[model samples]
Target: MHMLKKIGFYIVAKFVPLLVIMLTTYFFSRWLTPSQYGQYSLVISIASGLSIIAFQWINVTLGRLIPKSSADVKIKIINSGLILYFISSILVLFLCFIFGEFIEDNFKTSSYLIALLAVALGGFELSQRIFNSEERVLAFGIFQGIRGVVFFSFALCFYYTEYIYPGVVYALIASYILLSTPNIYKLLFLRKKDFIPNSIKEIAVFGFPLILTYVLLYVLNSSSKILLTVMLDETYTGYFSLGSDTVQMIIISVMGVVQLAIYPIVIGAYNKNDEDRYNIFSKSNQWVLLILLPVTAGFIGISKGLFYFLLPEEAYLRVIPIVPFLIIANLFVQLKSLIFDYAFHISKKNGKQFLPVFCGAFTSVALNVMLIDGYGLEGSAFSYCIGCFVYMTMSYLIGRKIFKYPSIDVGFLFKVTVSSLLMLLIVIQIPNDSIFQFVISIVVGALSYIALITTMFYPQLKKYINSNN
Candidate 1:
């Protein structure tokens, strides 16, 4: 497939699941109280943190190894990965059971079942990454879309039946199970093979350091919620989570697609020592910033009005103030993790990848501990943004020294920034008292951006767009 078409497919595939989740969250905000929503958010955060700790290295390993392996070697890697996953899943479950009380006390919920579901979710996630590494974009998308559909349908059912919290959890568990079916078939039934010790050792060597990397990232992302839950209450945590989720929706909608689409290509290009690798890397960053900057601005501009329609009035008031900070934080995160961090991965400097995130995570936790008590929600937002900035700066410096990819064009970046600012100016002027007005304002802002980009940078944009064609 053409690179652009592949990216488009991956984007559509990724976008469906995100869109479903977004809709689900919108309805969830309306139906559940802040406290109820907070509990659910806590469950999700804990589950995600635990899952990442347990299985993310395996995912990262597969992502690195699969694309570069031969057909026979790929099967061996898959078999080895399955063995590792089984062992890791068992260990994780046992640890969770041991620490069940501590988790329950900290998050203020029964966590044993959630932990079990998290192991399953981790397996499904690992499966998704394997598919991604193999360039099975369509299959990956289908699995994600199915999971989204199932979760949304079951969540709605549970809500109407008045079993909201348990319903959501059950829905997630069910979707994960369904998603894992194809993976099970691929590993156990279709390509059944013995576990190779050498393969296991190789994957472990490559993947183990990534455990620390992912754990630090989890801390950077989730420490705010954990701290808020401890310092104040689940209600505040809920508000904070809503703010993060709002920005995350934007990140996944664009950055997530780009990251997924480009990573394998970048890996292949590096492996073959392709001359155009720098061009691909630079263009990816340029396009990502071009779309991401304006979207972030529009979201910040429309946050109050958007939340007014999407969230309960009380929840809206609590969350709206923190949205812009969270948006900025996520922007830094996307640029750091999705764009600049590629250099580290491609260069096989996996250990070097640890420092920037560790610093950010440390900064985030320290600031959250010191600031949340005095400044409350705003403090968490501020701490997060500062940490993200620290991470991005470090990653950019390190990436430049190590790989030396071409920088994004100054003229192009200026044009994108100016166009986005113009869009923001027009968007902020539209009265957003109602949903219709909000929708129209977003459309106008987007069209204005498109118009400006087309007029101002038409030649460059046209050449870049046609390059892959």
Candidate 2:
């Protein structure tokens, strides 16, 4: 399928579900205190990290190989991946059981929560990877949409239950299980009896390094909130988490569709004609900047509007000031993870990918320890930004040594930057007196950016449209 159509399908796929999540967050803020939400966020973050550990390798290993593999190899990959999934799930749960009570007290949830979440989130995530790897864009989108609706419905229901935090989680787990039901037999019964067990060894060698890499990545993402919770209080953690989560949502919604669509296509390009891989990578990077820069700039442009009933709760209003920093920081983080570090996957020596992320993670943690006591929340945000810059820079620098570096079109980047800045200038100048006006400004800014960028590509677009007709 054409890349544009794939991305368009994913836009609906990601957008609606994320929209539901964003709205759900607003309600969560209204429904629970910052401290309560902080506790909830902490548990969720830990479970998310566990989910990454338990399932990421399977998804990523398959994702990297599936596009180019023969049908027999694809079956081996899936079946062997399931074996790894079972082993990892059991291992994580066993460890969680051992540390159960301590975790519950420390993170403010049942320790079993991680076990459930690791299974639930990890299970569906593996399925999504399969859908994306197979280029089943519509299936992927529908799966996510269903999860979003189920999450919304159950979350609302769970809020009134006695154990609100755990109930919220149960709602999400239920959704994953609901969608995952049909895949159960397919995952188990469809396994080839003649599968080579060495495929398991092959996967371990390919993906083992990623385990620690994810620990560092998790530090870059959530350790700050954890540190805040320890250094100050859960309220502070909640404030920081809300901003970070919103930024994460935006980055994923914008760039994730591109990455998902591009991953397999680029992999196919690498296998068929290695020389074309650079072109594919380069073009996709350009598109990422085109969409991400303007959207991020616009989001930061009127970020203060977030406090104007977007959060609804007065306590969360405190987060507005730091939200922009988090937005910029996370933007760099995603650009690094989704774009630059893709070299490692293609390099097939993903082992070497660890150092840059380690350096960045160390930087963020050290800075947080040094600054958070004095500068407080803002310091954590600044540390995060600087750390992300280091990660992206180092990844680009080192990643080039591993594989052919995708040549960045500096000229195109400049044009996109200029267009984004102009759009930001126009949007920032708009009076944000009312929520209505604030929303209009966002619409206006988006349209302005689109118009400016589209104008730059007008001749090519016109030629393509004319040729198509």
Candidate 3:
């Protein structure tokens, strides 16, 4: 129903464009030298980092706040979030300018690239946040599609014109601009404006906790690359990031579908405050694991071939060892996110839930700094794994202490664990022919997962589907 439709739309919107963008980026990297590709990766990492830091939780705040208020009030929240984002972007730009020379000299990015990257970062945050707010899921997809089109088209144009670096930057800037245009138009015209909140203080209050959550979440996710950048060098940072990126494609692509479907359902459940709804939430997590576990195991098992086929040989071969670890870590990270972040937001404990998040963030940052220099990317992976484990454990304890919900299902864990382990075995025993091994691994792993779910978890899924229908 609604959940399926929304999830379907979200997947189409986010993943379709992402697939195009990934293909474009892959080719772009192939066309460029290792150093050039490394620099490209570095700039993108920094831009993403800036977006994370600058986002300030407004998007989450809006998602929570918008439906609760009158349309006018929602408009105000949107405007307020936009204003906050603009100011934050300006602050980020200032910081970049201040550190630009040092970063370029030491970190291998040029000042001009940083400046352009700053603009791209700002636009990306604003437009993406607004897209989430509008819940114009298809529009969001189109926005991403436009970004890919503009980026690849313009870059190719510039590549042909013998302006490589500027071409890439121009592509990014133009794509962001194009993607953001719809929001800009909405902000400018379509003039049924509402009571714009006079003070952003209330919004800030709600958003501040998520800001902490976002940063901690960032640490959980991206701090590895940052630490790698510091502990090793830009080139290693590039390799580690690419490997992380490869695994993340698995996590995010899958999780993205789950989030779109489950989030609004969670919100509806919270609003209703019914145990039945809570059970639905629990079952959904089980379903996510039922699907995610084998996928993760397969990725870990066949990561080398996947990376090699998808990326340049040099980049793929060097980063192969890191992929399996990251894939596992990403699974834990996704679990932590579902149990901790989404669970809290749904249960209305977001206001007072900063403690565990801060604890995890500090732990992640500390462990990353301590580990990455010694073990390089492996250390970062270990830190991520440890941080998410602690965070999820803490969050579950706190969630139980506060809400007394059925925090997790033991049956769900047992089934998923068994399925994941079995799939891992099947995949690891894959043959020497790389392509054949990959194909067999995917087909066999998927069939095994579906078989398990149909036999064990199907009853629960059927009940949920029947109830909804």
- Top candidate (TM-score): 2
In candidate 3, which residue pairs get closer than 3 Å at backbone N, Cα or C atoms, i.e. clash?
A: none
lDDT of 1 by residue, 290-401 (tens): 7778878888778778778768778888888888889899889877766787788778888887888888999999999999999999999999999889888888887888
lDDT of 3 at 349: 71
| Candidate 3 Cα RMSD after full superposition onto the native fold (Å) | 3.8
Using Cα atoms with residue i matched to residue i, what is each candidate's TM-score against the true structure? 0.90, 0.92, 0.84
Q: How close is candidate 1 to the true structure, as a TM-score?
A: 0.90
Ranking 1 against 2 by TM-score, winner: 2
Off by over 4 Å in 1: 1-4, 101-109, 160-163, 187-196, 459-469
* Tens-digit per-residue lDDT, 135-207, candidate 3: 6667777767777877888888877776776568767877887776655665555333532545367767777
Candidate that would win on lDDT: 1
Residue-wise lDDT of candidate 2 within 66-160, one digit each (tens)? 77788878877777877777778788878888777565476534688767887877888887777777777677677778887888788888777
Q: Looking at model 2, which ten-residue stretch has the lowest summed lDDT?
A: 101-110
Between candidates 1 and 3, the lDDT winner: 1
